[model samples]
Target: MTAPASSSTTPINKQVGFINAFIAATLMGFVGFFARHIDAQGDFIAFSRMMCGGILFFAIIAYKGRLLELKEFKLSPTMVLSGFFMGNCLSAYITATQHTSIANAVFFIYIGPIISTLLAVIFLKESMKLATWFALLAVFIGMMMISGLMSIDSSGLSFGMQFSEKTFFGDMMALYSGVGYGLFLFFGRFRTEVPGDVRAFWNFVFALAGITLLFVFTKPTISQMTSTDWMWWVGIGIVCGFGALGTCTIATRHLKAAEFACVSYWECVVASLFVGLMIYGEPLSSAQMIGGAMIIVGGMSEVLISILGKSFKRPDNVTLKAGSI
Candidate 1:
């Protein structure tokens, strides 16, 4: 008896997805600010985030009387895999932040969009529009500029930079994080039958398990952590963990893998601006400023083109489920 979602509503849903993804990226940007304040190791920070977020999600589901949904939910391999990837991604990103400059870590982690785009094209069989390619190129070039790989000065534009031996490990970890994040996006595109909250809950659970295992091996001392450290952890857990992840899950339900990945580059721009200007008191170079603008423009252009370029066609494999905020 219920009417099917019309083509008109499809664009609106996609817009909503873009907005939620943008918000998630914004919340994620503040993660470094909280992580730096905590004296804990990356493993412990990640573990705490997952634990707290999982608990918060559980509480919300219970409050909404949606516990029945979990009871009826069947576990899927894709969901488990996605959750594990998310755990690894968070852990590696946090570790990278501790070892390398925020700019470098962010640059490496943002390679996720590229990875996701490729996987979506190959596996999801999603068509890549010319606009998407242009947006991706712009974003990649912007990231290069921001990472100091490409720079413009009074002399001219230069390419390449010296690598630091000290940050090599962290750089690798960030690259791994990007791969994990890409996989997370890819897998998240499947298992559409699961409600967003239920998926997020399991995501937290598996991520917590994975990080806990890592924590057991690393065994970083936590005795030095002050009350302030605990407070920051709780704040991050609530904001970036619960808030950001929840919105991101909702976004996955609405956007295609490649589309979500492209819009998610906003995270890098937000992170770079926040870490560079606010926390580090570092002045933004002309190149960095221009790079950030390009990223913003690229992301926005992708969203607009997706909405306006063609009629919405639902994928056969993916069910466009409506998610409650």
Candidate 2:
């Protein structure tokens, strides 16, 4: 009844996980588009996302006659903690978008990778070499450029002062979201024994609880939404909220924390593509073009190095698995 047994992941699973993570990232890229269509307060949207997604997840398990699986494992405190962080991440991100520029919000949320990297190194004992650090630096620079901050002069301190007072709070919320995301990633890897679905289900349950509590406190709105609004919320819940988030959690099973951190940058790149070509119908800015190129270069460098290193290792483990990295 509990989660599936924890087993050594095969090369195939790792590769699948890698693909899933990127796919999830791509799906997440369109979140803004959906947000534009959904007419609701951020907290309400956050709560609805968790509640709807969690319900659907459980519904799937029940349909498969796997509902009993919930009873097999007593939910751990860590699971509860992970859910709280996950909910906080979602709430903060949604609210951040309301207050800050999309670019700034996206960039700040990605600070999760750096925090995740530090946690993985200290607690998970993930190994890293100088090359990886250099790659991370490249990623950071690329992020700055993509966020449209590369042109700012730090000496003038004008950039810091430029933010409106109202937006400053949003920036902090985005930063907090990143920390919550880092903690969520850390706790997600705490128990490999749990199947990704089981973990995701419980995490959603707790996230729903937290978000619902927030909704109760905020009372953002009680007016009836149109059918179109309902449809948009449903799309977001099914696609971005459940589908994207579920795959992200599933990825933790096969990929190490640090590896996932490296891969997370793809979200920004993917989002930018959507924003530029589809939504805005604007050409890519020079900074965006340069930044996107660097992000790809840096991300691919790390992935290639990790994959090739693992593939060329001792004869005991010789495989050119794409996700082995």
Candidate 3:
């Protein structure tokens, strides 16, 4: 009798991927907070970050003559339009953070996964098993538990002095921002006929160029921006270039969609840590630490449950039921 073939399982690899995704998300989470200090205005901030990131990417692609990758994709126009929409969506998010508390913005913004995932199921006909649906719920609840922020901006300062001060307008902005960004993300996932690498690069480039034209019309002179401001803009650009574009693309290769979404709460937790350590240097609040721990446990539990369910089920048996997503 032939020896049984060995199964390949890599928990360590998966965990590494999770860490990568967490870092990416955490870096991205700071965008809203950073935008608060960008004096160029939110729309301009969006445009600048894209333009700077695009320029950096374009230079690299051009130096290596990666234009062929772009030329291979005939749907560059539609993809770029999608990117333009995404850039605007990002602008709206920065504005939302300004208008509302970070907690409200971050929390409401995530509701997009719910919206976009449903849209995907409805329009793209993507389906999940019952277990997956439960997993989704678990992941969502875990995220909410992780981001629990009842206190008003850690410090008891007045609304104007703090960034996370609760506001109705900010809440609305964050909600809409999440919905729009969600549409951008979940909608694009279905249209995978186009190369993701090409779309990611060119879409941002086109969006930057388009937004730049608009900026020119609105306020041509940017003389007010100092060298430090440019440095910040470049930093933001690098944040998008590597954090959003490079690292996320790499992580997606190793992560499933559901897993990626579920693991992303780590970003919020990391953001909280960054705030605690770098900006504030204040001790971690008990509520926050507990909340973060719960979120992680919940997300991991659901993922483990799904994996175990699949593992334990007979190969021929149907492991999942309908209405899962």
TM-score of each: 0.87, 0.85, 0.71
How would you encode candidate 1's per-residue C-alpha lDDT over 1-325 as one tens digit per residue?
1111223212236777788899988988788778879988888888777888799989988888888777676777788888888888989988887787666776677787788778877876768888889888887888777666678978888876445999898888888988998888777777655667887898999988888778767788889999999999888888888888777876876677667876776766776788768778877788988888888898888888878756444444343434323
TM-score of 3: 0.71
For every candidate in turn, the CA RMSD to the true structure comes to 4.6, 4.8, 9.2
Predict model 1's lDDT versus the native.
0.78
Q: How does each model score on lDDT? A: 0.78, 0.73, 0.57
- How many clashes show up per model? 0, 1, 3
The deviation in Å at residue 230 for candidate 1 is: 0.4
CA displacement after TM-score superposition, residue 20 of candidate 1 (Å) = 1.2
Give a tens-digit lDDT track for model 2, residues 1-325: 1222343322225565677677777877777778788789887777766776688877877777767667765788778877888888889888888888766777677878788778777877767878788878777777777666664344531232146787998889888888988888877766655656777788899988888777766678737678898889888888887888778877865666666766767777777777656687866666667777877787777777766676434342323222122
Top candidate, metric TM-score: 1
Give candidate 2 regions above 4 Å deviation: 1-12, 152-161, 222-224, 311-325
What TM-score, to 2 decimals, does candidate 1 have? 0.87
Residue 107 displacement (Å), model 3: 2.2
What's the true lDDT of residue 94 in model 2? 85
Candidate order by TM-score, decreasing, is 1, 2, 3
